[model samples]
Target: MTRVLLLGGTTEAGRMARALADAGVDAVYSYAGRTEAPVAQPLPVRVGGFGGVAGLVAYLRAEGISHVIDATHPFAAQMSRNAVEGCAAAGVALIALEREPWQAGEGDRWTHVPDLAGAVAALGEAPRWVFLAIGRQNLSAFAGAPQHHYLLRLVDPPTDPLPLPRAEAVIARGPFDVAGDRALLKDHRIEVIVAKNAGGAGAEAKLVAARELGLPVVLIDRPLVPERRVARTLGEVMAWLDG
Candidate 1:
């Protein structure tokens, strides 16, 4: 009787999907259709957006979705917000499966910025070799500070020219290792790194590499969303579903 919708994208979302499938939960996984080749999920998959809050509410009611587990990326504030509003309107239970944000540690040279614009302003006027580790979506924002050479690592190669004038892209996927990231930073003579505070071990290697190389990092804080129930672990999520 419990039909569930798993709003997914992150590595944690994949794990949650597997857990739901293993438990034989009646669930459907939804992708925002950003990635060209998304990781195959065990549950029935739906690509693209739910239009907006109204469309999402309609879908939930039409599909009889009793619960929604939002496991989207921390930076995906809009989609997360839509989920919150839609679930509330549909009178369905909603919970977020989110990882804690990464914290600066001893020996880590980090400059925390409230948003993308702040991160860009933090770069200053000097043109330094920067590792723009924030992914491909917001690459254009850095074009404002085009003096710096940017090193980008992306899951897919860009079909069009990058917005930045002095930027190069490395086509690869992660759970990247620290040694490789360290070598990459050294090879590029990177002076700084700009990254989203998307926590978890998969993307933490770059931060570790930066710390080891004594390079500064411009860390963008996660966007705030409407408050909702959140579960941090697989066990916790499953318990929430069971309860």
Candidate 2:
């Protein structure tokens, strides 16, 4: 039996786990436990960090994991790096199941930034209504400029300790429709859209809505992971395993 360690917390991760099970590989789905209401998957699950790369190496060694599949969110750079290094240290094969990043079309308005701090600065000093889809962890950077009213979306309801003071939470999941996204932007009177290029149809409707509304978007670039063999979809991964 192949002991596969799947690092996931994203939608693609769950799908990948299902694919692995269907391929007859014994899989362990691992998460960092950031969200309250996590996405459901077919495999057995583990949560919490591994105390960095050293701890992860220990886990890989003890569990006799043959493969490490990185199906984490694109913004999850640090964990991805840690996994790459840890798996190398433990002599395990690593494959990144990464979705392709979104591209801008002719009518698309985009401002690319290196990181979230730069993203906030690029927004300028105006108190414009903003739709922030940068996830909960990076919200602290926006606290410095709280003059803007933010419409925040998350899977779980944020606790009282959120960074932005004038922010309203919308508890929901996606694949959001273009119509719903347009309505959201219209209802919130959003002037700007801040997002990471987490590709796929799940949150892609927002990009189309932003384009239609002529809203300028501050896009945070996806972090670079170590160069490795990448499978764009679960089908490609299973093919790799078969060969």
Candidate 3:
């Protein structure tokens, strides 16, 4: 049986969905339902979590899913960890499709941090204009560092009042270009960008824009995940599936 369960929330997942659908592979795409409007996948798609590792294992057994491809965002460590545990319990083959992490290059001003809390600590006591790009879930942590004025870029607007007193939200999606990001940073007077090292073209323009503006970035490293079979590209993941 070649039935596959693809846990997806990134550009890599979208690409894999297309590849799987084009090849007429028996697969199901799943989203954690964090986004208000998720991009439609070609295969049958499911929304919401599988509860946890136990729920995931139950779903795998019920669906008879033989292989699992974890194409989630690099920051989605919890779900990835659950996938590793659930798949192992189910005796199903599993592989991760992780994008390469971003590196600081020449002309780039970066302050590397291990996590979101570390990024917040790096903001210092000065009330600088900050562009916090890490998504809505982690925004609460920034409340501790109330000195900085933050510009948050998110897919959907937050229904509740934001945690920070000096924060503003810009509702938008990406595949953003350098020109637009440059304009955004300048218009907002963003002194620094706080972002995760989520490697992919879709959200990478901000880094380029930051480099061009000579703005320092508080780069949060991806969380360590359980070791698993990994692939960097959609083709490689597909090959692993075919094999």
**Clashes in each model (backbone N, CA, C under 3 Å)?**
0, 0, 0
Q: Report how far residue 19 has shifted in candidate 2, in Å.
A: 1.1
Off by over 4 Å in 2: none
Give per-residue CA lDDT, model 2, range 125-175, as digits (tens).
989899999878889999999999999998888876788999998989877
TM-score of each: 0.99, 0.97, 0.99
Candidate 2 vs 3: which has more TM-score:
3
lDDT of 3 by residue, 1-243 (tens): 699999998888999999999999999999999998999889999999998999999999999999999999999999999999999999999999999899889999999999888998999998999999999999999999998999999999899999999999999988899999999999999999999999888999999999999999999999999999999988898899889
lDDT of model 3 at residue 7?
94
Q: For each candidate, what is the lDDT?
A: 0.95, 0.89, 0.94
Which model scores highest in lDDT?
A: 1
